[model samples]
Target chain A: MKKNPQTAACLLIGDELLSGRTRDANANTLAKALYAKGIELIEVRIVPDEHKTIGNALIDLKVKADIVITSGGIGPTHDDITADAVSAALGRKTVEHDGAMKILKAHYAAKDEEVTDARRRMARMPKDAELIANSVSGAPGFRVENVYVLAGVPAIFDAMLEEVLAAVPDGEPETVYHVTGEAKESDLADGLRDLETALKGLKIGSYPGPTGKGGPLTIVCRSRSASVCEQAALAVKALFTAQGKEAEIGQGDRPA
Target chain B: MKKNPQTAACLLIGDELLSGRTRDANANTLAKALYAKGIELIEVRIVPDEHKTIGNALIDLKVKADIVITSGGIGPTHDDITADAVSAALGRKTVEHDGAMKILKAHYAAKDEEVTDARRRMARMPKDAELIANSVSGAPGFRVENVYVLAGVPAIFDAMLEEVLAAVPDGEPETVYHVTGEAKESDLADGLRDLETALKGLKIGSYPGPTGKGGPLTIVCRSRSASVCEQAALAVKALFTAQGKEAEIGQGDRPA
Candidate 1:
């Protein structure tokens, strides 16, 4: 098993999600991205737009995880109190940031629309916080004491993550291999065990996804070590092919 | 602050989610449900179909959260190891439960298929575990100790959760109200302060969502008490409308 790396916790805020009205895709993406970056995503908490609940969750994660990233409550809507709650958690007054306000003013003005005080609320930040860049939207996210606040919209979240991830220290990048053709997963179970034993540090997992044609298994091999992951994957491929199972090696790409 | 409730955490397992193939809708739904049930969802961890990662996350959540629910990684596929990892966490050997086997046999027989050994794996559970009824799928979920293992598919997960929730104790139920047509959030700032001050146990949140015509502002009020929540919402409505702002009631039920 890989020793715990730098860990992170995520807090998702919204009511639409709780009512099963909207599905969330961010947690899964963030988890995969963090895993490849060698950051252990230890926990995720989803609370509604309740100030006390959000405040408590923030305080708790700050004590537990090395970093915390929050999404959803940063919007210009009335329910967006993630920033306020984060401020409460840090015992800092939520104040309008000049830079953020400037950006929002420019954005609203560029679109030739009035920047209502409600819209201006998007520019608020915790005391002495750095701004997280939002490439998808002009409304920037903020960071305070290791907590990165981001917008809930998927496009903005994905774009902001590129910058957020750049700031996070990398541990080990994960690798992957695709194996397919005429093999039941159990057929390779013994070989997988052998590989797991041979490469103790590397973690190998198989996924049987529906190939475009049909159900052909995609054996995914992952590890913190690039070399170890590749070696194990190749060994598995060689063994499976020799045993008359059609298996193929996939190109390695670190999860974003 | 409601003084921390019983801690709860979730473990989401599946390569479908990791690969961005299946957009996860369950995490938020469960988080909200758990929160309403009075379990403070402390953390949610997503792991692929790797034993070590799943096992580690399971152990971690078990120790951290008072109750833990895991979804996905319970299937006939070789990639599924939630049962094994769960067993490992409980320090119990995985054994095929006779009742589960019987259920699985009946399910497969209904579909006119032979129960393969791989299919039999779905019947495996840790010693002395109770089953979470799955009306959506024949493959059932399990609950043991503080952990409630559930299916990955959204429909099945929802069905199982209905039963699981009934068996579990209900937390304090929260009341929600909608206050709409507020001219500005700042207009209600003073009123919000007074209401929050008066309703000590209640939480007053203001959210201005996009009304259908993109003209009116909505103020949402939430509290554990129905009367308090209604009173707060009424106070905000009267205060805002007095200032020539359109103020009507809204809900935490729908996005403000």
Candidate 2:
């Protein structure tokens, strides 16, 4: 068994998210993107824009995972304190990065505008940071060691992630085999438990979902090995079949 | 200045959420619900179904806020390790509560079915737990001291929250005044910074949002005092008006 699978944690920093004023679109977006690259997002922590709180949470998340990514607080506003907070967490000083400022200036220059001090805020990051290029917007995110500080805006965050993902070494992506059937989650619980114990390194999840679309329940088998995933799926299908329920293998578990 | 607004931290547990197989609907739902009840949701932590991870995360969150609520992992399945993890977190032994067992049996009895061992798993909780009633589903959630363990399903979680909210003492609910205008977030950033400093204990947020629906950007003022919120809102409106933009004051920031 491989000891490492590339674990990551996300620190979602924003007062808007904590205040219930904004539904955070970034965590889910990052989760999907990271999963596609085979990085197991082990933990996600959402903290307000308070300086000490952000710093403390970042430190906590940093200790938990290999790559720690943060969304929000990279913008050009008072609440945008993610860079400074992350810097403080690492016991480093935040300074305006020349590369980031050049990007910001050019982005604003294209709009025939000067980069104001407010706009300049986007350039400030940890002193030893490497810029994460933003394709959607001009303002760039930064990387300090394994930590990636990203924009809170969905478009820019998504755009910046492509650059970040390019730098990360992808692990063995889990092979998922999803089977849906008439068998309820509880009906297959015992049999699924036995299968889970029997199959080493195979992760199984049973979801109680929509009724009319396909079936009432879904049993998803995921593993690093394709053969294990297939075996688990077949066993799950047999569990449903034993109970006189019809089961179907699908492309993926995302219900259409 | 009031120091304490009843604070809450949520621990969302599920492998499906981490794997990006499911989008978590509970955090936003709980955040809005808690906010409406005057509870400041200070932090949210999402951890997968691994036993130590859940327990450790739960213990960590329990220290950060006045109330800790957990969503997911209370089902009748192998992956439903939340109750056991939480029980272990508190250094308490897990036992099948008679009351919970009674509820589970009654629920199954209503469906003219016997409660299987798998169904019996729902009754297992920490020794010193109080039942949190579930109106939507028959299985009851448990509260261990300040920590409330609830269902992961949106509808069931929402229903269980009603009872949880009823028990929590309300804080001075933050009053929100939303102003939308053509002025960009950076256009008002410097002036908004002054307003934030001038107004003691007022929290302000600037969101870059949709155009054509109403306007380009939104300025939200939130404070425990309604008067402070109003003053901040008016100040924000004046800033937009100063920028030659139409500013509209509205009930809340949920865009129409």
Candidate 3:
């Protein structure tokens, strides 16, 4: 596992998403998974299913991040051209991988169905790409260089991500601490800025929930050093206390 | 109102979104609103709260699309550097808008709360930027050139978008038709390809829903011309019928 914090980008390809017909869940799922493994998801792009668009985005994102994970456009349809786009981006020929073919064949054979040409299309991959196991569905995702092309379906995408994450080396996970208070963000903004400046490399964020919520202002402090994160969390709590407000630490399940 | 289809992009800036701590609803809400106004949301980018990242992304997205809408990072916090980034991107100085200051002062005064400096920070906007009305919240979003900077909160973002959309010119709205069936996408892949080729300027997409759903396969046809979209939709339904599968038209409310 790599100790350094690695950067990741998510490329979501689907016309439905841009059309406002579908809200994407894959990016959020992938982001959380990558964060747990100490990888920072720096960028997320949602592009249409056009070949040129997907191919261009893949090329651009690969240059910007250490790893790029793409979801969608890997189905058995004409618009499902993610494989071809990836091949184009990598300057590799799209070919039927023997391992991917066997997986699809076995899955279909067990169901008493023939492997049709359209179904076989799912087996095609960029040359030199390695297959990523898809336990939930028959069609497997593939990795070419730092780009991992996964399924669009949320269930299958999540399942395949588990395997992908297991294979990838872990990076330096960030230690995070959450503090919630009744004070408005504006009331503590200056103090938060001072704390952030005093503690270098400490990232703090303030999220204000709706009024009447037990603690409307939730502050998140994250750093590679757990001690630094803990220290910053205390400082945040002190700011709320100075405002005559009660601050609770570690009450929220997620970061702000 | 512009008669031709206008391309738009959304730039969402926040660490919480990338951390999976906050699932973005602003982009989806903006996308849907823009679609109704005949604008095509071609790209959506979620970047971190870093100044350079946000500034660079804003410059890039503005070049590609006719309009760019950014949500998040416009709050009173250390991480809320979106205004500064936007100012840098456009090479404009940040200044307090008199109108925005009045709105913030009135809102806070009505609540019998003192207007703090951190709260006043929300009044800052890029030079030459016009304020967008925020009926839900006092802090107004600002428009600079083709870029519109909006709040991150879902309710506030949605409300501001309504005003922004109303001010922008309407484009040529695409007419969409949906057809869903039980047939597998692969079974109709070849037919879809043929239909796509036959209908120029028509965009078609295939989305497969989860199993056990009555109509798992949905076909979406979209075009500026209603007649053309309707014609392509019928072709899709005919393909499903040829496969001896029942194709239901308009069973779903949204496009596939």
| i-RMSD values for every candidate model | 6.4, 3.2, 2.5
Error of 2 at A247 (Å): 0.4
Full-model lDDT, candidate 3 = 0.86
Which 10 residues in a row give candidate 3 chain B its minimum summed lDDT? B208-217
**lDDT per residue (tens digit) for residues A1-256 in model 2:** 1234388999998877876777887788888888888888998888888999998887777777888888888777787888888888898998989999899889889989888889888899899799889877778888887788888887778788888888777877888888887776778899999999999998888888622122478888889888888988888889999999998876455445
B1-256 in candidate 3: lDDT tens per residue? 1324399999999999999888888778877888778888999999999999999999999999988999988887878999999999999999998999999999889989888999889998899889998887688899988898998888888888889877777888788888987898888999998898898888888888743122478888888888888898889999999999988777223443
Q: Write the per-residue lDDT of candidate 2 for residues B1-256, one digit (tens) a residue.
A: 1234388999999988887877887888888888888888999988999999888888887887888999999989999998899989999999999999999888889989789999899999999799999877688999987899999887788888888888776777788889987786777889999999999989888888622122468888888888998989999999999989888887675457
- Superior by DockQ: candidate 1 or candidate 2: 2
Residue-level lDDT of model 1, residues A38-147, one tens digit each, is 67676666666779978987887778778888888886655678988999889999898999988878876987866776678888899888998875557899889878
List TM-scores for all candidates, in order.
0.70, 0.95, 0.95
For each candidate, what's the DockQ? 0.18, 0.53, 0.61
Residue A58's C-alpha lDDT in candidate 2? 78
TM accuracy, model 3 = 0.95
Candidate 2 positional error at A69, Å: 1.0
User: Across residues A8-73, which tens digit of lDDT does each residue of candidate 3 receive?
Assistant: 999999988887888888888988888888899999999998899999999899998988899998
